[model samples]
Target: MTGKGGTGKTTVAAALALGLAAGGHRTLLVEVEGRQGIAELFGLGPLPYEERRVAGTADGGEVRALAVDPELALLEYLDMFYKLGAAGRALRKFGAIDFATTIAPGLRDVLLTGKVKEATTRTADRRRVYHAVVLDAPPTGRIGRFLNVTAETARLAKVGPIKTQSENVAALLRSPMTSVHVVTLLEEMPVQETVDAIGELNGLGIPIGKVVVNAGRPPLLTGTKVSQAELRRGLAAAGLPTDRATVSGLYAEAKAHLTRRELEESLRVELAELGQPMVELPLLPSGVDRAALDTLAAELLGTR
Candidate 1:
């Protein structure tokens, strides 16, 4: 439930899901956006509504992915609340569901939650199916509204099946086992967003399970008072065989790159002030895979 976007929220969710699966928990990875981000990250074809196995239990554990559609959840909600009968048929004929969902405020969030709730409790052939469900939820900013859908409806419908159902859903969201996490970068915007999100979620009684700051570079080469700029000028002195132009250019390039590194270090210092166990991931150009995810998940969960 990270309050920020582009802060590796999806990546953290995916890694956690796969890591749990690897540890032999039959895991379900649910994406609310229906965006292809999860599929693209996992190198799988885009998921359909139906639960489909994306990875085997042998290599990892049983891992399944699903993209929940709010509209379908709305239809289910309608059926549960009202026996449409003739009205349902007429609505179906004219595509009223589609139109209504499109215009209805907060309907998408309600539907999304409904779909996830359904998936979370599902059983397969009388067998306990998924042990854990990882939601690649909406960004931190929208998550409060998204999860508050049930409460919103309960307020609207003071009494009725809708209200009752909404209460039941809300109970699930507020459960102790229902943990919310945030993923962020060491940068200002993301760190600020994380702070804001935590405050909002705590106000709404959502437990902050963890705060993961991914793609953090460690202090690999440190404690050097030999400043890059000072070293640059000193190193700029030409070798016996070198000319001034070539030597100056070499130092200039090194200075620029090292300056960027120093800036990054400043950001990391700011991040340290947050007072949480920040999970630092290496700056991997290629995104997370099973191996990469394993490495990072280990770092995150303190297994490494």
Candidate 2:
């Protein structure tokens, strides 16, 4: 999942993992940014560079999380392809791993994405390790370049192990099984970024999944106008004070809410023009906790 910063893409990604993990299926949630966001969201301590079970569904399904570090991934890559096990650690001690990733950032992306590819395709005893994998990818602005690892690494290595690794990653990303979901709010800037990101991914032949609208508020007060007299009458009828100050305050708040609702409705209309499946997550006034995540998960799976 990807979106503009502050659009709650990470939360959506986590909820998606939970949703997919329902019904006796295993799901892997991968975090490429070193934020430990999944751990924080799930109320766990810092996660190591290894996959660990973070949460489980009611029906024998589970969610495992992995925070992929580019440096560690590079070390694993070297050991896997070239058997540079001890030599890889020695290079790390000499800061060669960091230097390599720093100088050629494309290699860093390759390693990170390559690891995801491995997890997605990995099988044990003739069975896939995880039934589904959700990648908490970079923001929409950088996502196209981030996922297009082949293009980025082409300049660095024309033909080598790196080229082959990048190609594998690219192929998986462009495959029919893969879909890029963009999250956004019912606001102008976020919606625009979602549009741009979808267009970029389409140009790259990447499949577009549902567009998620996060923190969406239901329209409480319908219609264009609610006069002060109406508010005063409603307040009086409800056995509350009908003072001028109280009536004016209530009217102002209602007006503002109505205005915001109109704006959100218009933005929703604009997003509908994109011609992609859409999902809206309600604004959780209590903020996101385990229960809230469950709520979002159900919403995502259309089981709510």
- Report the number of the highest-lDDT candidate: 2
Weakest lDDT window of 10 consecutive positions for candidate 2: 217-226
lDDT by residue for model 1 over 91-210, one digit each (tens)?
A: 766887778767655666667776777677779998768878888888977878777766677555677765666666677888875888878786778877777777777788766677
Residue pairs of candidate 1 with colliding backbone atoms: 2-140, 3-140, 57-61
Prediction 2 global C-alpha lDDT: 0.92
For model 2, how does the per-residue alpha-carbon lDDT over 1-93 read when each residue is reduced to its tens digit? Answer: 999999999899999999999899999999998998998888899999999999999999999999998889998888877889778889999
lDDT of 1: 0.72
List, in order, the clash count of every candidate structure.
3, 0
lDDT of each: 0.72, 0.92
